[model samples]
Target: MPESPHPPELPARLLADPEMIGACRRRDFALVFRMVKKHAGIYPSMIARRCDLTPSRVGEVMAAKRKLLHMDVVERISDGLRIPGHLLGLSSRAWESPPELSAADWEPPSRPTEPPGAHSLPSHDVGDILASVACTSPRASTVQALRSSIEDYWRRDDQHGGEALRPAVIGQLRYVEILLMQSRGDTVRHGLLGVAAELARLTGWTHFDARQFSQARLYFGEALRFAKDIDDRQFMANVLACMSLQATYQDRPTDALALATAAQDHARAIKGTPRVLSMLSMREAFAHAVLGSRSGAHAAISEAHRQFERISDSDSDPAWVTYFNEYKLTVDTGIAHARLGEAEIAEPLIAQALHREGGTNQRGRAFHTFWLARTQLQQGKLEQACHTAVNALTPASAVASERVTGHLREFSRQLTPHRSEPAAVAYDSRLRQVLPAGVSGPPPP
Candidate 1:
């Protein structure tokens, strides 16, 4: 299909304010679908299938009859149709509840503590330093250094700066923002497009780190759109892969598969680099495994392995795909196999993965531990399973992923036969400690 024409850029003033930019990012389908129909002349059926939605449902969304949408559905339509999400007015921050009180009503209490040594700079002093840096260096490196300085100030400030740091960060962000805007202006230029996409992705990661999924999704969607616009299939695949991970966390395996499949198809159609293809295929395998399609999952996984084998030390993969390799793929495969009740095969793969130097992310380690616990439970090793479950619960409690908690809940159910045993008691205690209120006990035997 021919690519859709890029929309006219928003005015500089409009993009200056975060709120206005956010609103522009969260566009409504009423507008987007109309534009799609006008530009591509594609019927609703084709759009629905590409987006994995029923034609009727697409009609509802297009008609504005439905006010709510699943994130994956929005992502699928955006990516599949090449519609920039920012044009749809989908801001990540829009979903948050409004502040409870006006600024005047919520006056700050008098500070009792002394100011920290590093944060003692007067507002004027900080402003002057920022101005000097901007005047001297117009490049991104300088802007980033200034941003880092402001962040350090915020971190060290005892006062929390109220609204003080806002203006400074906004200034630094403006410099970086200009760099991104210039890059976007030359969207067809490969180097410019890469810079713009990287900026959006980093901004999205910042939101993700702050536990703002809604905002994170918007930035990620924009990054994905720009990546595709530039015909950077590898970056596009990476963005889709991240979206698939979000779907898995949200407990929507079907949506995950749809995203992974799109990524895989795009990778293959574009003859993407080996590393990109491998990552996409691995995601496809994971989605299939989640849906209990064992043979399909195994085939997809084997394809991924084959692609990885084709890679050479001299060939460079995208920076984002660096974390994916034999060890990670094996762990993912083991999780899939365990879910399929192939404990004998799953256990050794998982053991090997654990034996390797796992990544530094505590949450990932906790998830791997949970998968191991599941494998043990399936093998009827109750005591061993319970021990693994306790380890999983420790780090799992620190992370907000519902998938980890769900797995622990399932393991608890599997241990019901020995509920009164010491290991079962310990497992139940851990579950109670981590689970939300009113979560019922596991299903009866």
Candidate 2:
């Protein structure tokens, strides 16, 4: 017989117990499932494959939607997990006895502070192996696979806008959700939830970038739930920070402030990574700017700078946060200043950021370019502003970003007062020609 990829990781005593096998045979699945998860370390997806059952059927059984009454099914379960057949009321001769367990081997590892509803599998570090006398369980290869896929999609989204990858991302998210439901063991489950949270956050951010507010909010809420389930305070703060950014763009300063404050509270409570802390603080600064609180905005911006400086090369950033760097901070700070009518201060910072990371990110370039043009116009450089603003339309036309469209529309409206001027008329006509058809009327401020 082929060896199972997910061999039982439980101690020999638990595998020999009739009660455990009886639970599986009788289909008290939740009890059996938890025992399998805690003791065997075998995920349900693995079990379904071994038993030649569909994943949905296995889920139904686990969830109590279906019963495990058939003798053939019971036999399959016993054979699949390599459970001793006699315990499942099969012939004793039909199965080989599993290895015996010593009294010392029966003791479960100590995890006194394991949070309720959040299980953590044993750490993969060699220290864990050397520290415990217990046999090593199979490492969760699936977790690493999921994490790789998530990171891949994230990089794709960064290079190309989400429109090309959003559907595929959503599909991957749905698959991850299934894995989450099927997952067993604390470490494995928590890892799955972490991946889910990151994917949810990415999906939300993509939708937000595309100007699909409702979908973005839905995914953000979904991400928040997963983060909360695992009590991942840092990731929760990340999701809230994203929510705050969406609110700021939607012109809901009060909502933006509330969400940013909530994110900061989480960051403080957890003493989060410096990068994450900096991001939350930056969001807070933007919120303050939107609310027209100059002193508050400056205070938050200074804090953001401090937090960003605290991020050292040795500090490891989580996959979701590696994108937050000095260039991003500069752009964010400049936008906050620009939003508050500080054109002179905003222009240089924005221009520097544009000269740095803006070329690689079309969406980022479009956003900053429009703001640079706005700052120029604010400083009464009408001709220069018109030309710079026109340059932004190149990316705006190519990308399916609502923020870019909104910026173009706003620039056109700002030029309306100077409509009779040759430069303004030419810029206005260029904006109209560059914008996608049917996007008429004023856009969100």
Q: Which is the leading candidate under TM-score?
A: 2
* TM-score of candidate 2 versus the correct structure, residues matched by position: 0.66
Query: Which candidate tops lDDT?
Result: 2
Model 1, 369-430: lDDT tens digits are: 87888788788888998898887776666655444445555566567678899988887777
Each candidate: what lDDT?
A: 0.61, 0.75
lDDT of 1 at 331: 88
| Runs off by more than 4 Å, candidate 2 | 1-139, 438-445
Pick out the ten consecutive residues of candidate 2 with the lowest summed lDDT.
Answer: 115-124
Clashing pairs in 2: 119-186, 120-186, 120-187, 121-186, 121-187
Ten-residue segment with the worst summed lDDT in candidate 1?
115-124
